[model samples]
Target chain A: MSDRKNLNRAVSVARGYDPYTSEWLEHEFESYALLREHLPVARTEQLAYRRQFNGGWLLTRYDDISACLSDTDVFSSQSSDYPQRPWIPQAIDPPSHTAYRRIMNKWFTPEAMTAMEPHLWDFAGELLDKMLQKDEFDFVADFADPFPTVIFCELFGFPLDDYEQLMDWKNTLMHATDGHSAGRALAVAKAKELGLQTPDEGELPSEVAGQVYGATAAALYEYFGGLLEQRREHARNDMISQLIASEYDGERPLTNEELLDTLFLMFMAGLDTVASAMGLIVKTFAEQPDKRREFIALMDDSQKLTLAVEELVRTHAIVLLPRRVTEEKEFEGASMHAGDQVMCPTMAGNRDPEQFENPDEIIYDRVPNRHMGFGHGPHRCLGIHLARRELRIGLQLLHQRMPDYELHPDKKPELFGGMKGASSLWLRKG
Target chain B: MRVEIIADKCQGHGMCNMVCPSVFKHDEDGFGYVVAELAEVPAELQDEVRLAEVQCPERAIVIED
Candidate 1:
């Protein structure tokens, strides 16, 4: 069916593609065709987690998503989190944000990605071998989850033993459904039990949700804040240590809080994104055996393999970033006012027919794939290089070891509300 | 074929490098530039160069024949 029809259906459909709605739960991108056609700048007062104020327009069209992302002045990425606090470069607007990004840019450059490949290849093999040893295992719990987390720990010089704790902290704070963390109480079961509907912008059951988020966030800060101080005294060859010694504004070193904030942003951006991408990649390849074979045939050629990964990234695009309107403005016939949170669905944008020749279908070796999977403009994903590296090597290793892997008989992917990913991907190796 | 990239418009998407490596290369900052000293596309790689021109999100890559 035409996505436009689905989009119109959303109007009468309960939970109409609301991030927390049952309609969205059924499928996130199913209604975007309608959204892009009719509601390029549609406004609503309902949201899943953040209900501070009535919502602004949700930009679903390809051009609109790009316009909002690139227009730094009108659509600012400044801290939209309630009880406003700095979130490093992400929270800061440009000129200043450019400087902070510059400091961290060198850490994730193409050169750095190349340098880390050998290490990543060995590690991916190590993890895949371990998984292959097991006849059947939850791909996520077995490899998809811990693989990136462990790599994250090694990259930042965080204590290796604390990887589990770090994952717990991250999953709890980032992944939530009802009033509890999906990591702890389990989001799917909670969703089923509560059948939670998307609350109006100001109608969120915030008291409990706020406390849960606040408690989790505080614990993460306390843990990482101590690590920053320790790094200051005993610096090492890790990104965390690099951040600690780096200077900004002038010769003044970054404050402990800035360092902590920056690290927090990196944690949220890096680990879950890669892991989620891997789970989907593995799951998709497993289901489409012929497509998997086509991808494997290109595995020996680095250039083609890289292009395949880009196409896969486009097909399974994740992340729904929200930007706040800086002032009253007219954009593509949609009027936006200051302080309105504009939800930009990059995942939907990636599938826009105007951009890709066959946007909905995954085309391996899709040349010139200008996908917004990493987003656009200055605030574009700082970890793009590193993420691409992880996906490339991770998939390469998976196909090499378990060429015939497929999803377990009874299990399907567990997709979250806002972010699209496979939380539970059960696999059986051939 | 001659080529040029509007660096300001280039968000460093890196599609140019993927499409025609011999024609374009991303600098240290991850932005793209014509790799040939003359900023000219070789005839042998002309097809690939056109491919990148289409792929660039910013439409930063331009080709003149």
Candidate 2:
């Protein structure tokens, strides 16, 4: 097949050869390199119901992605763009987004991180100890999955007993093989993966996926809503209580929908991203012993460890958000229409050669590194304090407990292309 | 040298604190704040402060001599 044909096959939004599949997922950066060099803003029709569903322009360059994120006016994040309900501050923009952020910002403040540091350390230590006690362990199931999940649940006041199942719901909705399962469930998931903000009712997300995701969403809403009301009645020193009690501009406070949507966004965001990061980072260490040693050397060095966390995140940014053009506009040499889906491939931006020296390398102390791992602009990650602290403490505890470790000799970790993460990673301690 | 972090642009990316802790410290919100005693970057830490200025993702930190 021609290079163009191969790239097309790899970039397909709808079917057979999507980025998440082996055709593109395994060679993601190589394909992204091609896309960046030849077609910075390549457009692709989503495979499923191409007629009814709209395709989008994939923004691959670092500057373009950064510009679009910063240019909120032309590229809207309003909930209307999504087929489903809005995710509070993530789906809102400007004054309103800023205001919503201010309320949650208190929960992620530096002091909050400082207070949570010991707990994060404890979580990391406990997980690492269990993994280290044995010579063989599945890092993904054992550590990556629970560390962030537990911290997120604890900070937000979710019942600790439900951690495993909440994570299962997240995995089911996100990481299932494309188009492989029951109707609506698979379609909603695939449509989501394809960055299809709005899918025609009959086009995809068969009735089952809708019901499945709907049930999951409703269950989650009730879960958080119950907590919000509880907190409303009896406040606690947790994030949910703060959010429930949050008020601004005397606008009669946030409605229940607003709180639920915000919690929904938090619920989804907090569960998977960090686990993905840990999976990818651990997978790399398993493969690259040298980098692992280098990382271990910096375990006690706060400055170096902090910088290393940023660099690792840059090397392996896991989240890719979808934005729709508000109106007709010319962006990065592409003429796009209103209501067009534009995927901001943050990970691709992190690897853009124009943005970083040795862009593909894991330079532990790369300085002046302005990578968009946590994203950029007004809607940048609100949970960065917690994310950073988790990364640092997680790695510190693991390396201290199992300094010399590698991938299980018999089994290799499974990785996905989109929002990359290991399905399972087997590690062996020395 | 005077060092101040512009609140509008700062997204609490802690680069300033990492680069020059003496001159810059993270506030309760996790955003870098100019340390009161060291706002005027001491001669020894001036270079570090400049590096922080260049490295700040939002370019939030400004060191004015």
Candidate 3:
């Protein structure tokens, strides 16, 4: 039963939705329903500072979002502000994207991901053991955050010791704001204007956040540059080595910049996404014991486990996919111009009532659940197999180790929007 | 039912192969394609073939009776 009050708030948010305000993040599903029903082509002018687009249309309905994702020619991934440099494959359009993808497809196949299962299970068991040692611990910090990040580091050949520092960089890049109280006040005023909660402010302060973000990116480029050189000298059995050995378009080796950019994308995309998914999903389970019990009952059955992971991912879909309009066109009753932005919140599309019979309900065995959780079209997540394996293994080991757990009464889970994640999720064993 | 993956639409999400590996296998580049011998789904796997068809995010699978 959707709350009418939430729907009213969502309607207000749709009218003047600002990316920086975080209002839409709080009541996301309600916002999705209201926008999909009332304003299928919702428009917002308040752009994030680093974003290039001045104004954009938000597509809430599944069909519209899917159509946008599929038509790469019309809705280009080259929407990033960083035109001088782009994340390989992701920001590239076909046939270039196709070529880049060809080089990578074999590496992320279901078979390849399946090979990593034993190692993933072992690592998850180790982490879960450490986590269960404490009666009450932060799920995000203890299990969710480190579990995926460590696995990603091992795969990418990054040092395990640098995970903390790398996470700081990622946090700064993804979540940190200008840190200006004036800006925060303005955003709060805007949220108030929309009759929403106070905006979730970034932890880091002004100039610091920007500096850390910039420095972190530069450090990553430099770090990868050196690693690539070492791999070139004598290739190891790691992703960096694999990239070094693989030819680009069956031509020459990829340029240093290309290698660096690809690694950069990998670092950002691989590190935090699954961790966020875990945080959100576990938080959901902690709050809903019935769902937790259902999940635990199905844990031993592989097929049911797979479907459960998919359902959890569908319900907790996190990415807010952005695209650029390459040419002027009339789309879904909205006039999209060349150079305009299109925000396709997968979270919204995954929950659209028009697409699913009961959009909000998490049906573990929901078939044809072609949800946009991993996105759609050519830009579908390259790590889909790995992500699924990680989520499944993570859930399995978590429930096996601690069958019954609940949120800590004193500590609260901190959820943030825009590639939404839980910064803090404290859980206690029963 | 006989099934085929539309090449142009298949971006290799590999959901088909995951759903029914016996019927769906991927090429060297990992894009899903019907196993040549099993392109015509066995009676026992007909349900799985249909599941794979709908699970495909790209809607690349075309099934015929």
Fnat of all models, as shown: 0.33, 0.49, 0.72
RMSD, candidate 1, Å: 4.3
Error of 1 at B14 (Å): 2.8
lDDT of 3 by residue, A1-430 (tens): 3667655655566656644434556766766777788777777665423464756788899999999999999999987654237898788999988888888889888988899999999999988888889999999888888988998888888878887767766665566542323333443443354454442655434344444455557766887888888888988888999887778889888888888889888887988799989999999999999999999998898767776788899999988888989998899768888888888999889988767779899899888688889989989999998999899889988988888999999987777667877878899897
User: For each candidate, what is the lDDT?
Assistant: 0.74, 0.75, 0.80
Tens digits of per-residue lDDT for model 1, A1-430: 5766665665533233467422374656666766666566676655522556445567778888888888889888872663225688777788888779878876776767778889988888888788788988888878888777788788888898887777766766666552222453532333334455434332235454455566667767888888888887999999899998788855789877788788787777777888888888788787888889998899889868777888898888777778878889888876777887888878889988888877888788786687888887778788787788888888888887777877788876666656666778888876
TM-score of each: 0.90, 0.88, 0.91
In the range A221-275, model 2's lDDT, one tens digit per residue, is 7777778888889998778887777785446677888888888888878888888
Off by over 4 Å in 1: A1-15, A20-25, A82-84, A178-205, B19-23, B36-38
- Candidate of highest TM-score: 3
User: For model 3, which pairs clash?
Assistant: none
The best candidate in terms of lDDT: 3
Q: Can you write out model 2's per-residue Cα lDDT over B4-30, one digit (the tens) per residue? A: 889878877666765676777766445
Superposed model 3: Cα runs more than 4 Å off: A1-12, A19-23, A48-50, A178-211
What DockQ results do all the predictions give, each relative to the true complex?
0.45, 0.54, 0.75
